[model samples]
Target: MSDSEQPGPPEPDDSDPPGAEPSSRRGRRPEPIGDGVGAAHRTWLEPVRSRLVASGLTLDELVGRSGYSKTRLSELLRGKGYYPSWEITYSVVRALDLPPWPLRRLWTAAAREAAKKQGWIENRIQAVQPLGLEQPPVAHQAFTLAMRAPYAAYARAFLQAEDRAQRVVRETFDILWLTWDEACATADVKRHAWQMLRSRVMARTLQQDGHPDLRQAAFFTAAQAAIIDLAERSAHINKMAGFFDAVARLPQDQMDVIVLTHLCTIDAAAVPGIVGLSPAMTHTLDHHARGALNDLYRQHTWE
Candidate 1:
């Protein structure tokens, strides 16, 4: 089927007993639409608004610069009614000449919270028939799963360029859509999606860097130092910078272990499947990673 022919929700069967809802309605609570999400949405967009003001850019200027409609841009700044698309958010960031990192991070957090409040993922999942069923796969459902995957974590692990990371994520979803049937057969769809995304991101990073070894000592050091500098101002950012720096310094195997266990929060038994390490070896690597992080922290403090 063409990608444009998106699937609608399955038709309800009439065989159900009276007063019984569809199976999709079973055990699912109605999604909350309350003040919590609105507060988070406002919190996330406040910085964007502040930056735009500080940059001396008006909504009209932003609309002209970003090529987005003034109404859409205004809606995004107000953070009400609808969650803005990533494209719109990115355009606004570019128009304001703001550093994308912190704003992107805030946007991600806010978007995720808003999605949860609305039960967006659950609603999307329920809208489609089960994978590998008689019906053809739904393009929108596949896209939703890909969007909900941890592309950000993989992007952080391999690439520093925000635009490149975004591209990788978009490509990951495209590939997922193409391979939807194959993915449905997997026992763990989310893990399969993550692996596919990681491999693609890693390959892209390797191609772009053109270095025999993608992980360069100088590059890691520089990136870590920048994180550390940010850490000086915020205690939370400091802890995160130290953790990322230490992870970056680890050997490839140990780094994979830490990322899988800590970042991905995968179980120890599952590490072997993902990284080809034994459970025992995974535990050992975790122990060593901790020690290495401690040592790195001390060294940073001393220096």
Candidate 2:
């Protein structure tokens, strides 16, 4: 199609009577057209209109930005008509970048309507853009922790048969509950305790001669500080049983190695001595432990 061949949009025909419907009454506003229309729409659109205008958008600009016809947009803004489908609402919400209070309210309202007829699918359906709905001054904590749950679950299963399984369970809950005790101070204390424990343990072990990187990563090394900060903010689940059922089923020896090397972040070599694993079996244990931890640690920081 040539550029000129594109059809020009038609102007709104005001002469066409609005044709009042059964919903009309004396002093009553015209019904906003939609499926499952809510009262809020009657109240919100004129405000949306004023906001769009205040933000330097002309009526045509608002219409173009919203991907709605000028007539439809005007109808919405006039409180004479509106259709609050997620598609239309999303367009308006995105163009304006609605404030946090209004933004969350929109999703909450949409989600409630979506809930009765659907489950998780509807949850996603109701979710608006900028999916990180966690309000500012606090990073999006809920979704972040939700993302970690799978990793937590997987590692819990992977490390089954290890005694540190309890620690895994504990770490999961600890990560979840850090915010409950006041985020900053409690996190600082936890970080400090782990840090001192790692530094002291490493200082003594290096005197015995071992790899330093292993020592650093094995303990409260700087590499994992972000992990600590996030764990501090986490609030997933606590006071729940079956935390480290994985480690419980595993041999006590394997569990000790994971505790010493992973959570304690001590030298990896220390694990064999601590867990009492034979030199040959140490290789098998290391392979399994690394696999288990890869997911667990990755979850702590996934974007």
Candidate 3:
């Protein structure tokens, strides 16, 4: 085919379907290649890393569980110039059950960078707003960056994992926190809390494995925050004992969920010796147990 035979430059059709902006360029402006954890990086990285460290997981375990290369992981931990691999970093972040704070920063930084590179950034032209108090390269927009999509996706997963972990811990323990002595005295509250506890423990474990259910991920942040503070401020033994005792009185059907799920740290399906119920029955028991426990709470002084 001759040069002329090749299709002439296609017209930029106005009817193009809306989508993400292409990473194309027309000007000579330098691409904002990520230099060593830029100004914004320093602001969040150290504290975030420290917070991860404080969570109950060790770096070695994180590496082993995440399949991250150990040498590289150490460099990131020290903030010594390694870019975090999302596959590993995100999982540990999720495993620790930290909030979405670090991931949010990652998203913000990416959007800012992407917008900066493509000045006047109009993607899909979804409803143009009259120029507010700011201009193109809006005051806030300048700080954003286009993050790697895989990394961004990983960030979302990490946050979800954290939520799942927190939710599991909280749902399992919330009743115990507000009501203990009564919880222990009644078989009903014991049964329901056990089921709730089992749900969360399973959730956290599932989150670590990378397939968390979003429906059950929201309550943990607030609930765990309060529970942790209470645990820290009061006598640790008091809290732990209260929780243990509450778990002790539940029925074989309901109580087994906590004994096998939370305290034993084993899944019902996997551990034949623990809570030998079929998966379907376990779920049914969970629903029924919650109702029975709530009724018990109404009668007893859980406070």
Cα lDDT, all candidates: 0.55, 0.41, 0.40
lDDT of 2 by residue, 1-303 (tens): 544334334434533235522222223332334554454342345445545655666655656677776555546555443233455555776677654344334444434443322343244345545556445323324423432333233233334323433333333333323222233445343333233223322332322122222222222223444444555423222201122323333343454455455444556664443333565676677667556644544444211
Q: Is candidate 2 or candidate 3 better by lDDT?
A: 2
Residue-level lDDT of model 3, residues 1-303, one tens digit each, is 543234433322223235733332322222232345553343334444655545545555655665655444555555454334343345545555433333433423433433322221222112232323422223212212221222122223324454544433432233233233334456554344444444434333333123333222223223334655664634443444444344434554665554444433454464232233457778776566556655544433222
Q: How does model 3 fare in lDDT?
A: 0.40
Tell me, by TM-score, which candidate is best: 1
lDDT for 243 in candidate 1 is 55
Relative to the true structure, candidate 1 reaches a TM of 0.33
Clashing pairs in 2: 161-249, 161-250, 162-247, 162-250, 163-255, 164-255, 165-247, 169-243, 218-265, 219-265
| Over 4 Å off, model 3 | 1-36, 107-303
lDDT: worst 10-residue window of model 2: 235-244
TM values, all candidates:
0.33, 0.27, 0.24
Please identify model 2 stretches exceeding 4 Å from their true place. Answer: 1-38, 79-82, 107-130, 137-303
